[model samples]
Target chain A: MKVNYFISDIFYVCLRDLKHYLKQRVRIMATLIQPIIWLVLIGNLMSGLTANPLTLKFLDAPSYLDFMAPGVMVMTTLFTGLFAGVRVVWDRRLEILQKMLSTPLSRTAIPLGKIAAAVVQGNIQVIIVLLTALMLGVTFKTGLAGIMVILIFISLFCSIMASISIALSVNIRNMETFFALMNFITMPLMLTSKAMFPVEAMPGWLKFIAEWNPISYAVIPLRTLVTKGWDWTVIWQSLIILCFFALCFLAGAVFFFKRARA
Target chain B: MKNIIEVKSLSKIFPGKITAVNKISFSVKQGEIFGFLGPNGAGKSTTIMMLTTLHLPSSGTAFVSGYEIKKSPRSVRMQFGYVSQDLAVDDRLTGYENLFLQAKYYHIPNQTARERIKILLNLVELEKRAKDLVETYSGGMRKRLDIACGLIHRPKILFLDEPTLGLDIHTRRQIWQYITDLREKQGITIFLTTHYMDEADSLCDRIAIIDHGVIKVLGTPQELKSRLGGDIITLDIALTHVAKIPRLIKLLKTLTNIKQIKTAKTKITIVTLHAESMMADILKIIQKNSIPLEMVMLKTPSLDDVFLNFTGRSLRDEAGNREQAHKARRMLRRIRS
Candidate 1:
């Protein structure tokens, strides 16, 4: 009985939240255009620069754009997903949340539905970036299977981030507090993810930090599949960790939000 | 009548400094409109906040439609609807789309939901502008749409906080009539809060006048009025009469049943069971004290009577200034921040 309610509620919320995706054509396009430009213009810009014969040790073997492409895609999703909570803030301000909460909808369904909607929205954006990368001669070495893997990688990554954002937005009462939370949390997670360089070139302490970062988990597995082909052993292990992070973040969010809203 | 709503000693204190809603108890019978009357700071919204499950009470509990608001909030919520004074509609969606969102939220069947949208839009008299985006709506139209949104789910109990606030007189009267019509026709129990004295007088079956987080009087408008009796007499005396009025009022209290006595600056308002009988004796005391009655008028008792009787202040006096209202909102918010 409970599970049925959960599924339907998620379906209902997602179906309706899609209206927002359509409504925010300008804002989404504006936010998404930055990453698209980076993938095409910057990726192409750095392509020739890094393809020189005497390559930097950190960028090793591959061109800079190629090495950086996976990072850019994941980073785009991370920021998009992380800041997705702002929409939830708008909903609270508009009393849409209060309206829904007063009804028979399941309380747990709300955050899950919002996160699911954000994940799908973020994936649409990821696909745009991927297609743009493809246009820029950034072919995936891992074929259709690699694209599938990358999609899963980015989806989980976005889901976890969106879940945190939803939790944060719902729990925090004021905009100022929310901004401060984003600064403390989102900045460090993005910077430490090894998005710019391979862990081999980094100092020992830095390498340890990179290995522990959840953002690193999001990129490395997908990057390996994209650039070098399959690494089955790590892929399965990383998928599990990603699932764990998504669950922990979402559960924490739903639980804390109930208390804060109460 | 079945107790469709029961609130027991509900208390909400903010951060150990502000007591938003003191331990107060009240209940609503099924199929009746209950009005929560208070000035801006009497914790009217806070009590509604607790009842709506938006703010948990520090102590106490409530049951709506046989489900505890805290323990089974979803079930409790399922039985009712809420329209907050803060006009929280989404401007992005068309009026129709917004209704669809609410229908989906309540798990209303799609077919029934469609019919409900049409019915409710018409019920609130917003049928012509249903396709327009809510952002494009006039203040009155948006408010009507909000009312329609609250009712779309066909909740047994509906809560409307300051439902007619900021509306023009015509629209306010229209809504006042519309709400009465809905309750009478649909048999939906309504819990409403308002600062407007007349709205309370005209609409509510029973009212609780609250101030400083405590309920001062709880009774039907007629019952509360009858308690005050015939008419209210206010004496705008010179400063010389300040000291004499209390003793004079005490003597009047002995001779006649003055429901309440409040001295504001240089004016003392006395509401009595017998306005004419008390006037003759009351004037003698003021005249003997060498204080002339600068102004005097006999008027009908209003919800303001209950407020002053309970809180020793008038709701129209702007007792809770805007600064204090925002400050109170922030005090509760600081915890999450």
Candidate 2:
């Protein structure tokens, strides 16, 4: 009975957040616009310069748009997941968190519901990015099947980032500090990963850092599936790493959420 | 009635040895509106936080609804609904949806949750606007909706921290009416905290006057007020030498009607049986002694006087000073963390 209550409470928290997402058209628009800009403008500019052998060697896709599609998909997930902290911060300021903590709801269930919502929303955003890439005349080497696999992989990756964000928000006092800290952290996460450029093209030191970055692990498999074709070894390896990453951060969030003072 | 909450030697000490609640002990009877009245930073909120299981006590034990606060927080949480000083309703959601979500948090079944939400909305006179988003609500309506959200789980005890802190007089009274109605109709015990003396005087069945982490007194409004002896005669003094106020107090104590006299820097309050009858004699004594007197007034004794009688300083001044002190402490903690 207690376990059932915990599950249902998590379900309710997810429902509440999803309802807020649907109600706010502005939030949807804001999250979508930034990634689409990077996908179109920068992707086209890089594709136009592909005649240079250096540029050609660095390009992962048949065209710059194809190469950047997976990067944009990963970027979209990271961007949305990092701001997952914003909602938690607002809830804290508004005392909504206090009310939730005062209830019989399980401690882990609250952050679980929030991270789940972000993952679900992350999947939807990636699909839209893929469609936009399709509109820009990009073709997938692994076709529709690859899109489904990449979507699942990106959702798992987003779950990890969202958990980290929630943990940060709970420990940080306010939004101003949260933004300053996330900016310092997320920019490194995005720039160090092989998201925008080929890892082999990076210098030895940068390449070493990219190899250790979790996003690079997920993005490499996504790019390979979108360009190289269906490879079980690559898919399963990335899936395991992504799942491990998600679990680690999920554990962190639960710890912080339990210790969170309302 | 039986006691529903028993706190023994409760205390909370912050990182730098700042004690918010200091070894305070008290018991709240079941089905009564018990008020924790105090100035800001008097540890009223810290006490509420400890009782609600939001903050753990440093060196004490407490039980809410027969469950130990530390041993069984989940059980303690199941019994009480807490309405914090700041409103907590999601503004994006409709009033009905907010209550519906609250019910789900407590694991109430859907059908029964719906019925309870409807009844609560109606009781709070919010059924008409239940479909509207809470952002559209007036301050009073938002507060009512917050209260309704707390009741969605039908908790045995309800904790409200300064429920009417910023509302106008009209809205404050409306909230008061709803509070009394809830206790009368549902038999839910209420525990509230406030600095407003009149609010405690009129609403609380019993009150604990806390200050600087200690309970100064505890009793019904009439009982506490009656402890003042009689009417209050306030005299504002501007002495020529400024050091003769104590001499004036010495002279006032000799008067037959003056039961008690408390002197501040420039004012003296005399608690007496007959302020009207002794006003002339009191003035004559001050004049005979050639002590400068600025003004004099007489009024009935009140909860504020009771607080003054116990704490020496006025509630308003203590609230102002404590707010600044708390802000400084918070800033320092933020920097350290």
Candidate 3:
């Protein structure tokens, strides 16, 4: 009985969020527009810069757009993951969070539902970007199996980011503070990780910081999967690191939310 | 009647040692409309929060529908519906959608959830606007839907915190009628908290008047009013007879039936079991004293009088002062920063 209620709680919460997301057509357009612009315009512009021999050697890919495709996918996931906190802030401000808490459902179920919806949404967005890349004549070196692995990787990576985002939303008092903190953190995270450029092309100091960034684990494996195809060592390492980040973030969220007054 | 809710010395002290709910205890019978009456900051909402398992108690516990709040919060939560001070419906969702989601959270079977939603929407008279987004609802309509959301799963007890706080007279009456009908039709135990004295007096089977984190008194409205011991008789004296107010109080006090006498500028008020019987004799004394009567009024003691008698201040005055103090504290923090 308890487990059944738990599943239903998660399902209903996720369903509500998804319904809300679909209802706001403007919001859907807004979330999708920025990433498409980055993938089409900026990816092409950056591809021109990587035409030199040193840049070509550093990138190690047949085409710059292909190299940047996975990076753009990872960036899309990161942006989507961070902004997933907006729903938490909205729910809290609007008393939906309180309403859910007053029910018999477990507290963890609420965040899990939100994280699941965000990961699913992020994956869908990533696929859309990938299709857009395909339309622009970008081909993946790997077959369907490798693309499947990358999709799983994006989902796991998004869950971690969504967990952290929701955790911050629970602790922060208002949307202005949440927006400011997310902006300050995401830009630095994206720059320090291998999202925009290859870590091998970076200076030694920058490479060190890039190596430490968790997003690099997600981006590196995705880039490898798209460019070099299936590699057990790469896949396993990325999965383990992503899982570790997800656990830490989820644990942090549950802890802070338990202590949160409302 | 069996007790549907039992609280034992439940308390909630916020951070910085501010006690929002001191060690206060009360219980409610099944199928009864129990009222927690107090001014703002009197801990009514805090008490409801504890009982509904929304906030953990600082020192004690409560049982709702036979489940201990601390030990089995989920079970306690399953046993009660809470209509909080703020509207809890999703503004983005239609009224039916809001209730449907809530029903799902409670794990009610889908078919039953649909039926329950239909029944609840009709009960609250929101069936006509069931398809409209709650953002488009009037204040009263939103409030009605909020209540319907609480009742979606048909819990054993319903907690309504200031259910009619910001409604017009007509809407308030409509909400009250709905509340009474719910109790009559469903036999669901109601636990209501309000600052409205008349609301408590008219609606509750019993009321607990709380103040400063403590319950000052608890009883049926009639019992509470009778505790004040009599009707209140007020005689407003003419300006020329203002000096005779103290003398009038002394004379009124000599009457054995007059239980209490208080004198203010140009007025003398008395509490007596027989205000009508004592009025002539009281007037005779005033006439003999050559003092002109501006106005003489006699009325049965109300819950307001009972509160004033017990708390030494009017409930409305306390509510007003609470707001003022809050503003003053906000200003002081601004100046200090």
User: Highest DockQ: which candidate?
Assistant: 2
- What lDDT tens digits, residue by residue, belong to model 3 across residues B200-283? 889999999888799999999988987878788998989976777776777777887778887787777788887778889988
Candidate with the greatest lDDT versus the true structure = 2
TM-score of 3: 0.88
True contacts kept of each: 0.79, 0.92, 0.77
Alpha-carbon local distance difference test for all models: 0.80, 0.86, 0.84
Which residue pairs in candidate 2 collide? Answer: none
Evaluate model 1 with DockQ and give the value. Answer: 0.53
Residue B277's lDDT in candidate 3: 85
Span of 10 residues, lowest total lDDT, candidate 3 chain B: B328-337
Of the pair 2 and 3, which is ahead by TM-score? 3
Candidate 3 fnat reads 0.77
Segments of candidate 2 deviating more than 4 angstroms:
A52-54, B232-298, B318-337
Model 1 TM-score on chain A: 0.91
lDDT of 3 by residue, A115-205 (tens): 8888888988898888888887777767678778889999989988988888888766568989999999899999998888887878999
* Local error of candidate 2 at residue B259 (angstroms): 7.4
Off by over 4 Å in 1: A54-62, B232-298, B319-332, B335-337
Counting clashing residue pairs in each candidate, in order, gives 1, 0, 0
Q: In model 3, what are the clashing residue pairs, if there are any?
A: none
